[model samples]
Target: MRVRGDDLVKDLKKLRKGRGILTSSIISHVGPALGEADCPLSDRELEILRMVEEDRTATDIAYALHLSAGTVRNYISSAMTKLDARNRAHAVRIARDQGWI
Candidate 1:
């Protein structure tokens, strides 16, 4: 593309102006990532809670996820600690309330 010198400056300014506009749609599209910015749980811990939401036992989740039941329990314990939850059920509820699972 070729343009007169004046047209080149005009096009450059237009592009810069467009880049400056951060629309709500853009933010909403990026909401999931930004939402977790303050989240204290690890990704693995979050994954465990999500499975916990499905009423899956640690052994069941471990079998499906190929992790040990002990590992799954560890993740749940960590998530509970981070969320200040009293137990597995509370952890799942807190995670759901925070939109983390």
Candidate 2:
């Protein structure tokens, strides 16, 4: 199950050529042995979740980001759905645990 260093480098080169960004995409080079296969949250979702982790309310986040409170709530909801989290607190915990925020 050990991959040679040269093989790993070659795989990485191929991956870099085929896929420019690693975000929102799974890298099969290492496979499931690394952990979960996908990161579904977008950058906006991560940003909102980071604010949530800091105990910021949707309204507070909205003011800080110059977005509507409803928009902030929507971002939190989207992140929660992606993370399969039950609430804002849960979403924060999941994101933190996964090192996504």
Query: Against the true structure, whose TM-score is highest?
Result: 2
Q: For candidate 2, lDDT tens digit of each residue in 29-99?
A: 35356775556789999999998988889999999999999999999988877765678898787666566
lDDT to native, each model: 0.70, 0.73
**What is residue 50's positional error in candidate 1, in angstroms?**
0.6
**TM-score, structure 2 vs. true:** 0.64
Show where candidate 1 strays beyond 4 Å: 1-37
Give the residue spans of candidate 2 off by over 4 A. Answer: 1-32
How does candidate 1 score on lDDT?
0.70
Count clashing residue pairs per candidate.
0, 0
Clashes of 1: 0
